[model samples]
Target: MSRHPRLAAVAIATAALAVLAAGPVSAGEPTVSDPRIVAHFDFDAGQTPENIALEPDGSADLTFAFAHQVARVTRAGATTVLATLPAVANPQTPNIGAAITTGIARAHDGTLYVGYATGTAENGIWRIAPDGGAPEQIAQLPADAFPNGLALDERCGTLYTADSARGVVWRVPLDGDAPAVWATGAALRPTAALPFGANGLKIHDGAVWVSNTARGTLLRVPFAEDRTAGPIETRATGLEGVDDFAFTGHGDTVLAALNTPNKLELVRHDGTHKTVLTAADGLDNPTSVAVRAKTVHVPSAAYFDTTAPDPNLLLARISRNKL
Candidate 1:
């Protein structure tokens, strides 16, 4: 999340301006150059790519928002459609009118878990089979609950999610009952509603690392500690719209996606930070990031544009050593 609370305010105002502006500007074909940017593939014009989950075998599982699609992209960059979401059953559904994939994670056994928000009235978790099967709802939340980011503790078979609407992190057992609040506070609330907005989440080394979108900082919450501990400490600041992140190698380093500036940042546990790549680096509206084998991969999708070209989805590759 961008540490500046004013960015969210500006975003809200910009959203209104965007609506008034109407049509979207044409974006050119994405290209990669010296900095090691690799434009893997593009999605359908209206498909808004969100989070990306890498398969153990090197393929990628991608989520699309307005297009209502989840696709599997092979290491060769071939995209295979997995599923399409159905319309909401209720009329008064909060954010349920549209099914958007806000979070995605893979379990130890290879099953995929996706978190989505619909119409504002319904939010829930869905399980996807590795071999490609229908997504099944495993848990559901109230109208006001909007689940955003997801992470899995493969060793313990536990899943963690940042419930932005409710201002809490929920812990869900893979095969057990529904999820419960594992952490909560004003700091984790949505950007529009809190001084600090919680957008990205990752569980590493027994601690939860969260991106405070509004406050423009990375916060750490020790496992099993009370909220009074005040999120251990802030990781980094001065970032513009840090939304989602991923750990490299053994979790010693992090790669974050900056939404507003459309950049990717590399942050070390020691507090050192550097902009690895930016919009100038060929990324536009990058919402989430993932790293594998020292290679930083980011998904660029038009989040606010309703009529942007569908194939605008791009997977950008950056060398980790450059960071």
Candidate 2:
């Protein structure tokens, strides 16, 4: 999902637009502290951790994209494979070009839901039990849909997914019903040059927030009382190559991962942002971010980095006052 040369082309085209959108909403510089590599994964083995879900005990569940595996990384730097999806015979998947596992969400009962983009019949959401066993396909999405970012709305008993190639948000009910399109608009679609659309998703404050990787913007879609989508709003822009993001537990503020730029930024409620971490802090194209209390969890897939690529989990302490 993260490209190097292609991303360079996108930067040339969108740089001026990003500067205009950036405006005067700068929140200063890096404020997060004590950033360190908590877990190291094998980059050559395709163990690129794409997304992360933090457990209550401080461990993290991740989707190893190219490896077709779901793993858990502990606070003490231990890694365990939780589930392995069936490998597709063909590697050249539609749109994004690989059969990989993208997003993951952990339910209250320890059920792990993940999005698999295989461009095949098994391209859907798979459920992994807490005890660990063969994963079950709970919802079958379209083969052409590249479901990337996933979020669980426990209150509504539903799961929301971002279709990176289709520019649509899909809603999957947990009651054995069917999955349906939740939202779609120009804002979620990708351009011809920039291939990825909706790259991240989250349910927060009675709304669903998503990042448009191609458009370099963050959008908010409110849920009506009946659980239908309200009007869409663009919360922030200029986040070129933004992948996945997490809230810092401070109202609507956010911590976003810039995939191509290899940086993490603290986005304020006023639409301004500032860099918090970079390659020097052990980020190799960070794909997603997760926050639990004061600890911040970030997984770098190293999808674009060619020289000295290191796919690992980087942890940092969230600044109580700065973030």
Candidate 3:
């Protein structure tokens, strides 16, 4: 918007592009084989980035963990903090990061429905006006439940959230009725080894697909015409710490951000999957991904696993020219 902001965006993009020319990938990983880096950003480092929501205009609204804020990033790489969540002090928890703002979904009219870990229904989900006015509470959730990923079906007049703590999925009616547990099964709960069960939620085709971070698996449940959930079926496996993903808008292909291994995977509807990009190519704890045509936007939450709290936000052009 302003000269300084534009220049900052240019500088961040330039630095990322420079890395592609510098070498095959960053140190300590295999060389990038298939998809390569197109653009990246080390923006607002030290603040953990979580989920990203894409705007029709090619911009992305990203949620953070510690900063408790939502930032809008443009195609040109410029960024603006759209909203700051209410202060949530959760010293009793292992890390307050888990209790901060997480999932964010924007309505067609620009109303943004955001999720936070306030542990109170009145404070859990807040709808922020497009003009960025005070947030309005809309739904309630478990005090121990951690709602991380949000998916909105405006046509269905419902919003869905994935509770990572217990591997439960809550469906909230837009009409403001009490939230209902639309889907919850063994697939939704966390395993002993992997304590975080469901992480990301997405509605595609005829089902609501969910990613399990602990089990490193992806599962989906069929949704009937009346929004009834069917059986849970495994979609893909071997994605440990699979945080968030976005449809490539190309057939059944989807791009997923792998957190632990620091990779971007291309998974198809046929159950076939492949590693398209690696951290050696500059990905670091990528928490989530958003797509626009051939361009893929990934945010590295850079959790404690990373030396820094905030890593870089990555932009890459995949081999397949799809969103």
Candidate 4:
């Protein structure tokens, strides 16, 4: 059995999605002149990174998708265990090793937020102090909500997470309120064959953009001045397994990590335009991306081309040049 029960389902669709190549685009971030490998997974402390958050001081915090652990990697590539989250197991199907992502996000002040579940229940979000210690539960979620990707809206002092299983975007105020559904629509729902929907989310330029992993769509929902949600707009369509993405720090372009086909793609604000960096350039199952000092850092989950979990994790970097 694969680590994720859904991987079998992912296999069914991968063959189809993998072949839909992205055409060239002129408007977005320029292709990397040099793509380099910075860190290789030692697989000693943690395994399978689902997301990456970079600290201002150049350290990186990552979530182990199946291991249920939180770790930090320094610029020099040393790993440190921050906390081991409570295991989430399905009481009925205990033997299956599902890689449920406990989404990790870091605030500007260096604090971290994580989300996890014990199978169907005991699901919620946690706040870890800057110094890193035992996690304090911030809010519990619905029994069915599998929180995957997390984003912090600093202006509202709120934390938002993507519920991949239920196609919901949930929110919890930092000041103390129960986690509640922030936004949901047909766009967030998953396709029948592949399971993930509303996989990654971010608060950028007064709008929240979410990627529908199964449906392969990048969606946008405007955040009103009062923090209310506007209508959902299909910013980009036919994105094959679009996962986590980061602002390129150049004009209105972003670098998105595509999982199934194993590549990094540069996307424009219109979402219709794109250019990609493929396996020939050395990317494997890139889960998410973060930008700092004009550099794009990505963490590869290395989840594909094998039934058993792969221990080889990789961190790669790309330097963006101007148009």
Give the alpha carbon lDDT tens digit for every residue of 1-323 in model 3.
Answer: 11111111221222211111011222222211334433244435325677888889988787866566787877676778888876655422211323467788889999898888655443367788889977777887767777778989999889999887768888988898988888989888875554567888888898888987766677888997777889899877766567788887766566778776677877766555667777676676787877776667888765534243335567776543322
Q: Rank by TM-score, descending?
A: 2, 4, 3, 1
Give per-model CA RMSD: 8.2, 3.0, 9.2, 3.0
* Candidate 4, lDDT over the whole model: 0.71
Cand. 1 Cα-lDDT: 0.63
lDDT of each: 0.63, 0.85, 0.69, 0.71
Error of 4 at 123 (Å): 1.2
lDDT of 2 by residue, 1-323 (tens): 33422234444444433641343433433357899998889887889899999998999999998888999899999999999998788744456556889899999999999999877878889999989999899998887888899999987799999998788999999999999999989999887777678889999998999999888788999999889989889988888678899998878889999887888977777777778799999998899999988889999988777677789999999866532
List runs of model 1 lying over 4 Å from the truth.
1-45, 89-97, 119-122, 191-196, 225-232, 305-323
Model 3 misplaced regions, further than 4 Å: 1-46, 90-98, 120-123, 305-310, 319-323
Which is better, 3 or 4, measured by lDDT?
A: 4
Report the C-alpha displacement of residue 261, candidate 2, in angstroms.
0.1
- Could you tell me the TM-score of candidate 1? 0.78
Model 2: residues >4 Å from true position, as ranges?
1-17, 20-30
Best candidate (score: lDDT): 2
Cα-based lDDT at residue 38, candidate 4: 57
Clashing pairs in 3: 26-280, 46-310, 121-140, 293-322
lDDT of 1 by residue, 1-323 (tens): 11211123434432221110112211221122244333333444335667888877767777776555777776555677887655566523232344567788987677888886774434678888867677877877666666677888877677888765566778877776877787777656655423326668888776888876665567777775432223556767665567788876544567788766666776666555666676666676677877666345677764532343222334444443322
Prediction-by-prediction clash tally:
24, 0, 4, 1
Candidate 1 lDDT trough over 10 residues, lowest sum: 17-26
lDDT of 4 by residue, 1-323 (tens): 33354344654674554334355546334665456665566333347777888888787888876667778888777778788776555522111235344678888878888877444555778788888777777887776667777899887789988877788798888888777898999899876777777888887888888888888777888987778788999877667877888777765567788887777777777665454566666676778888777566777776674643333334445555455
Alpha carbon lDDT of residue 310, candidate 1? 25
